[model samples]
Target: MDEWFRSWGLLRDERQRTVFRRTDHTHLAAVCWPSCDADTLYDLARLAAVLMARDHEIDTAPPEQSISMARAFRSEVSARYGLGGGTGADPRWTPVFSELWHSLSTRRSPRFMDRCLATAPTEFLTGCLVYRRRSGNATEADELTAYFSTRRVTVAQRIDHLLAEASLGIELDDEVLGDPLMSRLLDLDVDRTILIQDILSAPRELAAGESENIVAVLSAALGCTTPRALEEATVLYENLTDTYEQALTALLGSPSGRDHDVRAFASALNDFSTGLIEWTSHSVRYTQAETSNWTKPDEIVARGR
Candidate 1:
């Protein structure tokens, strides 16, 4: 069992190296085991998690003890398929098994785990078929093939259900992930450019309104309310405008900047300016908007009348 596991480990390392270099799926079919079903894939993932846990000192078990358990697990899987003891003899089979094992061991991110769970049964069954074939047990190949055909149909149905759920926005979460500012910036469409500009010039807009309270809010959000903050934002806006003008000048005078490119630059500048305007407009609104009433409503009404 020890020797079989060591051989499997070596095969996994080699397979990972080969798969890592390939850019397309052409090699995927070639590398997958004939009997590698989805269950086998799940088992492989579990094994990997166990190994990682042991390695990270999250699991208190000895290394040799873990290895023995892994060996036993592999043997049980082989026996369940009626393929009997130890690793198969085929060179190709070893590498395929190794690759699957290595992928499970290393890539433990949520996305990778989701993929592993989804495809494990098919991979394991296919791997088992491959193992049986390599062991010269061709008689059971037809049975394995029939089983895989049904499993494939089931998998296809499940995938369709998942797709429908995704399309319905069932998977969408309000919680922000990644860098919020960068994500917001990346998500900026032409229609949302004004909002972006407003965010960028918020401090300046608030200060211009003489709203010290609003200015403080903007300062807290931006992390720095230095005069340079407003100056830098103003300069960025001016630079963007100048870039557009420069392109236009070059297009008309020297035939240096392409007209089409200049048009795009102008459009971008318009977007920036529009955003700034929207932000400043909001600041003005907030400044003018009533937040408190020191005077009674009746007294103000009588004065107005």
Candidate 2:
């Protein structure tokens, strides 16, 4: 471990070095590789090594073991940070957990995945901190009472930070948390029914030529007539469009029709869009193009010759 720390030290940013030396599992998880922080560190190390090789005129093999150690350290950090203390009865935390699960299951981008993986530590630490702060006078029977409280501002701030990190193209281990919109939604209080309703009413952009495919798929799965499937498909399509529009409106200031139940609307739209992508793929077509016999059959018109 000492040797490993020394190797990490050689790449020294003082904060990073401190993060390494303290061996705080939460901090380690926050900066682990493939996560944005890790990717940043990796790039910095590579650049430093390049300069050293060029200027110092020294030949050095890449520190493969050190890289591996960093990853291992990150894993340990996540485990420690995510334990969430001994109590598991926080009602406030329940919705957060649900959002986390939803983000994990729905979003599939590589960037999103990395963020999700990286979030283990942050979520765990935050949950524990909230629990400790709010659950001071809890009794056995009252264990079911709300033991966690998160201000909307704090949640929003964290979500913004994560989104900024993701937007900068930082590689994260879990793609779900890396998804900009999903991350934003997860930060909100799920009990805010009005917010939820608004989110679902937003518009989405179907990937090129994906609407037809999605329609066909739903038609098969629901075992409905083509007309009925088409109607349902249109509804689904509009919902998906609304989701993207809403997300874009929220994140990028695109205009959207105001929604009454923003949060549920957003959550439902996100969920459906996510499901549509998972169900439709490049290979899901119902028909294949017949191969053409363009090779000039045998002697290519000996009659013409």
What TM-score against the true fold does each predicted structure earn? Answer: 0.19, 0.22
Off by over 4 Å in 1: 1-201, 204-225, 248-279, 282-305
| Candidate 2 residue-wise lDDT at 163 | 33
Measured with C-alpha atoms, the lDDT of residue 140 in candidate 1 is: 28
How far residue 50's Cα lies from its native spot in candidate 2, in Å, is 33
Candidate 1 overall lDDT versus native: 0.33
lDDT of 1 by residue, 144-240 (tens): 2343333333222222222222222122122311334313322222212322333444554465642212223333445675554455445544564
Query: How many pairs of residues in model 2 come into backbone collision?
Result: 38
TM-score for candidate 2, residues paired by index? 0.22
- lDDT measured at residue 192 in model 1 versus the true structure, 0 to 100: 28
